[model samples]
Target: MLSICLIFFYILLIISLTLFYFSMFFMFNDLVLFIEWDLVSLNSSSLVMTILLDWMSLLFMSFVLFISCMVILYSDEYMYGDLYMNRFIMLVLMFVLSMMLLIISPNLISILLGWDGLGLVSYCLVIYYQNVKSYNAGMLTALSNRIGDVALLMAIAWMLNYGSWNYVFYLESMKGHFEMQFISWMIVLAAMTKSAQIPFSSWLPAAMAAPTPVSALVHSSTLVTAGVYLLIRFNNLFINTNLSKLLLLFSVLTMFMAGLGANFEYDLKKIIALSTLSQLGLMMSILSLGYPNLAFFHLLTHALFKALLFMCAGSIIHNMKNNQDIRGMGAITLSMPLTTSCMNVANLALCGMPFLAGFYSKDLILEMISLDFLNILIYFLYFLSTGLTVCYTFRLIYFSMSGLSNSMSLNSISDEYYIMLKGMMGLLFLAIMGGSMLSWLIMVTPMMICLPFYMKMMALLVSIIGGYMGYEIFKYKLSWELFLLKNYFLSNFIGSMWFMPYLSTVGMNYYILNMSYKIIKTIDQGWNEYFGGQSIFYYSKNISLLNQMIQNNDLKVHFYLFVIFIILILMLMLI
Candidate 1:
């Protein structure tokens, strides 16, 4: 019965989303309208106008909704008997709603609200188990997100105060606000945090405690992409700023760091988590090159393939009876052919194999990097990260599906699981073809197109080499340097970040409570000395007796004086 209801709900959501986009198609000009609530007479037309509608939002929204719908369906079977399935579905609905709102928001405020809403929902889903570890991951996510939220809030406040609350106001007011460099930097900080950029990126790997569907949605399609979306939405603001260059540097660093981490991680989920971060870095680097459209395109393709990959991971874990250790299983490809096939497609997409979705988009990004002469370091980092991505992808595929393990018994993958796996694989296959179709229609026609065919070919060759290298290297003993670096440095760094709130909150609470206790004790001692042991009744009696004695003495004095006065008066009269 619950499964039927969930399906119906998803159908309704899809209908509504389809209607929303179709409406946009007819009233496309309305999208440019920047209505100002504060103004009555000053140019009642749209505050901002741009005919930027294309395959970007359309493609992204299509895949996002499609994957979301599939995930909902898959969860029906995966989470069938779970007690919290209803609650999970509700959160998923809210997450989808927030992402849609984000996609259509015309102004910064709307986008920020959507961003925060998605963050909150994702955190809730991450800790859905309500276990200590899950709660810890949720708290860590919240803390890191709060840092980003603060930066965004500051930027919003600055914009409203100095620039504009509406689109026209922003455009009109931006000319004189070159001095708002601080706000720009703040915006970058916020973007870095949202996109899981360095130093602030530790929360993502920890967030793997979430259910895989949550991982698929939050890590791949929606939550992390919010950062890249922000940068794209405000491309005008960042066009000529030094912040753009800073973004490039930050992105390259994030790519290298996250890729290296992914290379070392043995846990399937953590490897995916780190890869998501690295891919986000790639998107950021593309955005920094002033290619918002290209970045959006890449984001769409990444969303499709990454979500599929995570779902495939989820299916594998489910078939394995929740055993997530990659080393525990091998040579199960024949048993779980559906999962094996889907994973292979996703890995190809991830490794940027030729004709794959990742190939087209990632190739473009690298081409842009090379053409811009930005920095050789950026190019090296990009290539190195690509290689690491390949290594980890193959590592996951090989360990999870290939090789031989004598101790493990193969379980037949269920029909329901196969359907889900196939569904995801089909989507990836479509995404793999989408890039070429879009490029032919959108890129090849424009003489202004700057993408180099040679670079694209080179990237494909590198990806192929990287994949083979990854397969070859998997047989060797694990690198000791990687072990020490990951277990001692990277893991500890991420783990410590996760542990910070506990230590800080507990320590702060202890100090506060201790100080309050000392104050209470001092007050208690003072009260005891002043009033607790004193004889109040005795003091009151003493005061009453003193008052009575004074009154009686006054009366006696008056009577004696009156008598003496009367006698003296009588004697005077006689005389």
Candidate 2:
């Protein structure tokens, strides 16, 4: 008997494969089709529903569908027997629908519908656990995304100058138009927040409070990549402008920060989440460098492995009775060979190992940057980030796969969940082969590379050193003189993601929260109590009591009031 999840999975898989072939055909033929429906018109403005069919959008749609189908299939086993399994499946489907909508729509209004849909569904998914932690993470995720929503809205408003909301039609003509650059700024701001770049990055790791399938699908692929996808479409706005330079600076910083933070992270899901952030930064940086095709290629490949990585992490977490700490998960390979193998492949691919999915895109991006006339800082950060990526990935592998079992003896960890393994296996093949496949199809004209021997070898040299350092660092971590004990502040700073979580949460909220507390105390509880509701209640009660006494014929009070009034009137007459 087939379950609901299986039903959706089979249906979506067929659709994904169909779309994939169609996208290839369209790419080969250089075809584009637009279907627009004008719903309303008011003087100079119109409401339209636009559907764009191009190779890029179709290819992305196919990948999203494939990943969604796999995740939904995996969730069937991962979330088995839960009371709200149906609701979980529904949310995931809605998220897929939202991502598809985002991919197909070239109009700003249509994009916002998809953008806000992703944000809203992600928040729902994040808080799905119904715990305090989930609630906080959900709030952070939602609020951070709301900033981008606002920027998109502002962009929509500014688009009134063009008398059209379809940014697709305007990209070529709007170049070098200083008066309209505000729209580009708004678009970039919106993209930054959506993609979790730098200041907006704290939410990506925090969002690991969501279910693992959600982490796999939303954080790793669809939701976070929406911003990068949008930027790819808007790449024209960046040509011959300093906007790309500014974006490159911030994005490279995001890459370095996330890579550095992941090395210190212990939680299995969060390390992956931070890694997703680093990859998003890499995508953004390359996009800023004016290689939307390279960024898009990497995006597709990263989606494959990152989703698989999360699936493996989810399996481990589920089997470990929800324990996510890597320190407690050594020698996992002995029990779950398939899961460990899949995870290792994903990690190695992330490190840009030869011929893997990450290699074709990541290496090309690095090589292109080497050839470009970039400043020293950009080059330094890019290479440093590349090394840090390897360092953290190796550290993760060591802690989780290569040590003595820290778990209790009774642990039943194994790769017996065939349904989960099936989902992972599907992506495993792609994680191995997707890079070469995508590069051949997407890069119609192969890039010719010219670089110094040392520069050409820089990525490999850095990886070798970073791997050795990772092993040494692992041994150091287990030493009697733990680095955390001797240099608590430095370790804490790095581990805590440069206090970004603090700044994003308490630091940003403390003053406002304090002011709100004071207002509550002084107004609602203090002055308002005395002069507003409390005073009104008290005076009304006293007046009612006096009326009751008068009605009860209490002559003493009435006679005294009457005598005082008469004396005052008599004195006034005499004056």
Candidate 3:
């Protein structure tokens, strides 16, 4: 069955890659493939299934298919000898299908099919381990995502007022319609949850409880990108809008928060996961600033490199017998030189190193942001996040790939990892080359580039400083880290995601849990015990005792009854 799935992925990959060039030549304009159902109309609105095969969707689909195929192949080795390998593979395939569905559908109703499918299938994959941690993470992932699903549903309902469920028709034309403007906000909110923007970000890191392959695919490419893609498609509606301003605010915060969290995080997968969060923030913040194309460019490039990053992490984790903490890992480059080199490439790309895939989109986004109207705080955060990205990544490298050799001997290491290595090779190439190719293909109307030298080199400068800091902190054992010792609470606060997992999980449910406690106290314990069975039993027992006394025909009972009757007669006479 795994073999069959791999064959299917390979065929789809071939088909999508073929369409890549064809889509560029042919789909210069938006082409909607409509499968209309004239027989079904509601409130004079036409019901149709629509697929929009523009360059954007086609290119994104091709990339998704390519990465997904690699992920499937990687899973073959990572999941070797598992009891439910077939189930895992099918779930991944279904996940890819859902992503494809999401990519093609322009009609809101059609989108719901794919949107809901992505959420449901992701839940299954997150809980694949069938353990407590996996279960909790799955719930967080599903429920956080369900917010977007519900938001989309509401957006779909709102579009009914416009007499059509096809949102593609309304993107540009409906901007002047003040009443219809709320729909754009709804869509942004929906995008926020799906993209794991601030207040909705707890799930992304927690979701690392899933297998590394799922983490690579879902976190890097498909599931989280769904929201960003939706926003990219809906960019026309957000231009010059206040909602876009709000989106910019949240996305920047999210980027900074995730970068900050990554520096503090210890888990190897979580460091990558938080980095993914930070990149999503970068994408979201850029889209919020009205550069949807740049966001899309970054999104694609990010997918390529981030997927490679996760795959490298998986290779290391698998070889280390599942030890994921950086403290437990060292000298990975010694044992797995190929994997280490690939990991370094992916990390360098993420840092927007010269001419790499991430550099293309990331540099463009940062440059554009500098050109845009901005204040000090937002501007500072933008650069700070770039630095912190490098900070955490170099920190990761220093801990895992360099320093003291803590790993087992390097013998037989290269031979044992051929399958996983093969899978990563394809992604590694794309991570290196996909940026420049996609940049040329997608960005036809390039920005007018002009910047002072210091401004232009801002990203690079920060990256250099961040790298030095990471190396020094690990090498010298920084003083502030020890200051955290004096302030253990503060250390844990930042280290524990500012307690977001606690807050998102426990704080979100605080009110409902208290209400439940009240309900139990009032109904189940107090009212139920007194009135349901206890009261009835008490009265019945007393009556039975009275009956027993009467049936006994005791002399004392008769005397008391006669005395009570005489007293009543005397009282009546006195009245």
Candidate 4:
């Protein structure tokens, strides 16, 4: 029964994707009609020829669907025997539907609707375990997303009020307008929050409390990437504002900060969580530089490789009875040969090793950076981040699969868990060789100038050397003190930042409710004492005789009564 349902779901997904891609292709040729509707009428208009379909959207959609499909397949084994399996699968389907809607949406409203839907389903999946920790994580994710949603709403409101609601209208009307610049900056803020860029990024690492499949889905394809997709979709709006430079600065900060966090993280999932933030920063930097194609290309490649890596990590955890601490695992490579191989390839790809999907896409961004000095600074951050990625990836893999002791191998790893591992390996293979095959498709636009073959080769060499050196230096354990700098201020700051939201939330709730309760109680006591308790009844009784006298009708008496009644009514109203 489950198999039948899964098959039907996939069929619907494939059909929808096929139709959508075909429609997009036709749109590129100016052959598609814009369907506009009013309350009583429908209008169709022709579109102008566009280069939007050159490669970026196509490649991104392919990656989105591929990772999503693989995640679904892996979940079959990962969630096996779990009672909520069907419910889990449902959330996965809904997530995919939302992502597809987002990727194909032609305007900002549609994209935001899709984004909100994605957030809803992702929150459901994150808290699917229904435990306190999972609930906390889900709430944090929702709260952070609300910040982005509100920003988006404000930006949309401004655009509408300024007569630029529609994409075409906005493009036509926003000529040298300073308000548009402000609107663009707000949108960038929205993107940063959604992408889990720093200051707003703590939610992501906490989100590791979710299941591995949820982690894979988020880190690879859906929720986080939606922000980047939004940026690419609105690339023209961003080009004219300082928002681009702001995005670059934030991206660089997020990349380095996340790298530092990854280095200190002990839990395997948290390490990957931080790494996801770093990779997102890299993608945003490329996009900020107006290289949407390159950013999208890297986004796709990152999705494939990262999902594979996460799924592989999930399988290892499952085999080890849900253990996620790297320190607890060691020397399992000989026992879990297949899992080790998949993990190694994924780590290499993630570290941007030569000939992998990451190599082509990452180097493309670096090539763009070489054209300008500011870009070079951004690329330098990325280059340094590559070293951190290697350090963390190797730390994880080596701690899990390579060490010199039998004490580390308590339970033999299972081949039965290889279903997800095999799925990941399949993705790993594609990530390793897929870029060369897709190079022609990605290089069609003028933005994609070919780098010298030797330079590309040299870039590959540097990445490999960086990875190797990172492994050599950090393979053995080091003192925690080595990580602490200047009285451990920075680490303390990050830790506090992670906990600040929860602390502030609890503190604010207590303060407001407790303080309000005390103030109200004090007022009640004062009223009781002043009026001898039962204040309303006492007031009513005392005024009853006076009210009756005021209502009595006699010429001169009534005139005086009317004046008193008016004053009484005014006092009552004021009270």
Candidate 5:
């Protein structure tokens, strides 16, 4: 059945990709194919299930199906021994299907269906391993997303003021209405949760408890980009608003924080997760700055390479007996040359190396932002975050690729790399060329970027320093020990994801769970016990005693009871 499903998805992928490119070259106006099933109509408004098609949604859907197809094929080996292998493949397919629904919906009510499907399906995937760690991570991911889900519902209710469930129709006309301000705020909040921006961030790293294929598909590419895609679709509504400016401010902070966290991270998978978070921040910040297309370009290019990066990481982890700590790995360059080469290419592309997939979008985003009307602070954060990306990528490359061999003697670099590399080879080509190809296809006219020599070289200069710092910190083992020892408190805080996991789980649970316990005790033990069970027991006991007296066998007792009953009846008759 799984193989049959895989064959089906492959056919769909080919069709979607072919259509996406064909539309890219030929379709001029927005090509929309909508199906409206009028389930209900109230107060002159209609609710619909709409499938909207433009070049963007088609392109995104194609990428999602491509990654999912590769992930399913890769799972043939990655999940080889699993008892419920069929279930895992189904869950991945369901996740992709949900993302497809999300990408196409133009109606807010219909979008919520897709949105909630994403949350529910993601929770199932996160707990696929069903261990203590996976359980906690799943709960964290679910609860954090519920916040956004609720926000979307509220936004839908607010949209009633416009008399239509379809927000696409009114985005341009309703941009200036004060009553609709809350809708904008709520949408941004929902995007934050989905994108794993800032406070919603720790979940992304924690979600590494799932299999690497899931981490590649859900975390690196499709799921995280859902929020950015939504924002891009609704970008026109955010113009000239204080909320967008606030989003701009905080998203940059998130970008900086993610970069700093990735530098301190040692887990191979979590570092990639952090990089995903950082790129999300970059996309969100760019979207808030009114350049949705640039962000979109980056989103697509990042997905290509990041997914490949995870496949390579999964290949490494699988061969290393599932040990994810980078410190425990080294000298695999001699053993797994192909996987190492792919990993290095991904790391370089992520660093925005010249002409790679990441370069085409990332470089343009930075150069364009420099021309925007902004203060010096933002100007610096943008370039510094870019540098931090290079720093961590270099750090990751050095330790995981070229550092000392510290693995246990039992660890063997397996030669069974055929299936895994097969899955990655498709994305590997795109990660190298997708950026330039998409840039030309998507952007009709190019911007003539004019900047001072120093400004032009800013990203390069910081990236170089960051790379040096990464090499030194890992090359000199003493530096790692010294930094942690001296900066114990601060290091721990950052290393622990700024203590967000503790706060979101235990810290939150302490009071809320305690309150829940009290409520249970009050209802189940106190009020219900006294008023329900105890009272029923006493009343039943008294009734049994009265019946016993009335049925006594003694003649005198029976005669006395009968006389009293007759006297009471006679008094009632007299009255």
Candidate 6:
């Protein structure tokens, strides 16, 4: 069974690679294939099943498939003895298919089909552990994503006014059309939920309860990026609108909040999840700034390193006896040298080290931000978030890999999982070289960034300072007293994601849950009791007694009832 799964992934990987190359060619030639099958048609209106084969969709599909192939390969070793391995593999394949459906469809209705598929499959995968924590996480994830699904449904309904559901044909003309702005708002709101921005942000970190492979595919490319991709497709429509500005605000805040939260986070997977959130905010902010192309570039580059990062984290966690706290893991490089090496590469790439996969796209994005005519506050937040990203990356590195040993003196920890290593090695190569290759391919004309020397060096400067701060901040992890005494409240505020999980979960639900409770008490247990079940029971009992009397030939009682009925009829007739 494992061999069959591996073979299946390998074939898909090869086909995806071929498609990617073909997409590059098609993109260079400015080619597109739009195939539409009309499912329903009326006077001047049509509902169609549309497949849009273009460079963007095909390229993204390639990345998703490649990462999925790698993740499944890694999972064989990570999930080796799990009884439900087959079920796990099937769920992942379904996720990939849904993502593909989302990628190629230009019709909103079909997009919703793909969108709902992602939500349902993700919930299943999140609860794969079948524990209380997993169940809660899965519900949070599903309900959060369902918001986006609803938005899509609304968008579909609104698009009915246009007499077509194919958004590809309408995105440009819809610009400046005030009446259609509702659809734009709906799309942005939907994207925000899927990407986990602001109030929706809590679910991303909470979703870490899922297995690491699911996290790798979800946080990296498929589930979370779905919204960003949708925005990219519709970017032209929302440009310069109030919706765009609002999106910019929320996205920047999300970036800052996630970066700050990662610094104080100890759970390895959650830290990485927060990092994914921060990166997502960056992509969204860029898209909001009307540079969907740059956002797409960062998206592709980010998928590679982020997926690699998760895989390495999974390998480390596995060797640590499933312990995920970085404090319990120190000097991991001494034993699992290869895995840690890959992790370090991923971290540096995330920090935007020059010539790495992240540097090409990230450096360009920072430079582009400097060139844009944004306010000082936006500028400050962007740089601050960049620094915090480095801070958390280093903090994670210090406690987990380079710091002193904190585990048991005698424990088995080594990079002996050859299958897992094989998977990491594939992504390690891409995380190193993908950025430059993608830059060469994606940008036909070189983006000449002109900025002063200091401004150009801002990203590097912030990263250096952030790395130093990361080491200093967490230097005394073993000493709880000093750390807690100095900055408990401050750290707690920032570390808890600014209490977003509370606001989104308990805060939002408190009123609604209370109302539901009142409804149950007043209806289900109150009015319903009298008018529903008990009334029926009483009437049925009396009717049965009457029938029994009639069957027993109770002549006196029957005579009295008949005389009363006849007298009533005669009195009515006389009146």
TM-score of each: 0.77, 0.90, 0.91, 0.80, 0.87, 0.89
Q: Which candidate order results from sorting by lDDT in descending order? A: 6, 2, 3, 5, 4, 1
Error of 5 at 214 (Å): 0.8
Model 2 C-alpha lDDT per residue in residues 1-575, reported as the tens digit of each score: 99999999999999999999999999999999899888999998877789999999999999999999999999999999899999999999999999999999989988999999999999999999999999999999999999999999999998988878889888988777764688888899999999999888889998998899999997656999999999999999885578888898899999999988888888999999988999999999989888898899999999998999999999999889999999898999999999999999999999999999999999999999999888999999999999999999999998899879999889898889999999999999999999999999999788789899999999999988888888788866657137667888987888887888899999889989999999999999998899999999999999998788778856887798899999999999999
**Judged by lDDT against the true structure, how good is candidate 1?**
0.72
Model 2 ranges off by over 4 Å? 38-47, 516-575
Clashes of each: 1, 0, 0, 0, 0, 0
Where in model 1 is the C-alpha error above 4 Å? Answer: 1-59, 162-164, 168-176, 410-419, 440-457, 478-575
Candidate 3 lDDT by residue in tens digits, 95-172: 988989988887777788898999999999889989999999999999998888888888888898987877887877
Per-residue C-alpha lDDT of model 6 across residues 1-575, encoded as one tens digit per residue: 54746986797789789989979988999999999888899997876788999899999999999999999898888999999888899999999999999999998888999999999999999999999999988999999998989998998999998988888887777766754688999999999999999979989988888899899999889999999999999898888878888999999999999999998788999999999999999999999999999999999999999999999999988998999988899999999999999999999999999999999999999999999999999999999999999999999998898767888888899999999999899899999999999999999789999899999889999999999998887776656437766888887789889988888788889989999999999998888988999889999999999888878867898898899999999999999
lDDT tens readout by residue for model 1, 206-259: 788888888888876788888887777666666656778888888888887777
Name the regions of candidate 3 deviating beyond 4 angstroms: 27-47, 408-412, 478-481, 522-524, 527-563, 568-575
Misplaced by over 4 Å in model 4 are: 1-58, 162-164, 172-175, 375-380, 405-409, 445-469, 478-491, 494-575
Score candidate 4 by lDDT: 0.73
Task: Report the error of model 4 at residue 248, Å.
Answer: 1.2
Q: Model 5: per-residue lDDT, tens digit, 406-489?
A: 788866795566877888887889889988998888886877899999888877788888888888777876778798889999
Angstrom error at residue 310, model 2: 0.6
For candidate 6, which ten residues in a row score worst on lDDT? Answer: 476-485
- What value of lDDT does candidate 5 attain over all alpha carbons? 0.85
Best by TM-score: 3
Off by over 4 Å in 6: 38-47, 478-481, 485-487, 514-575
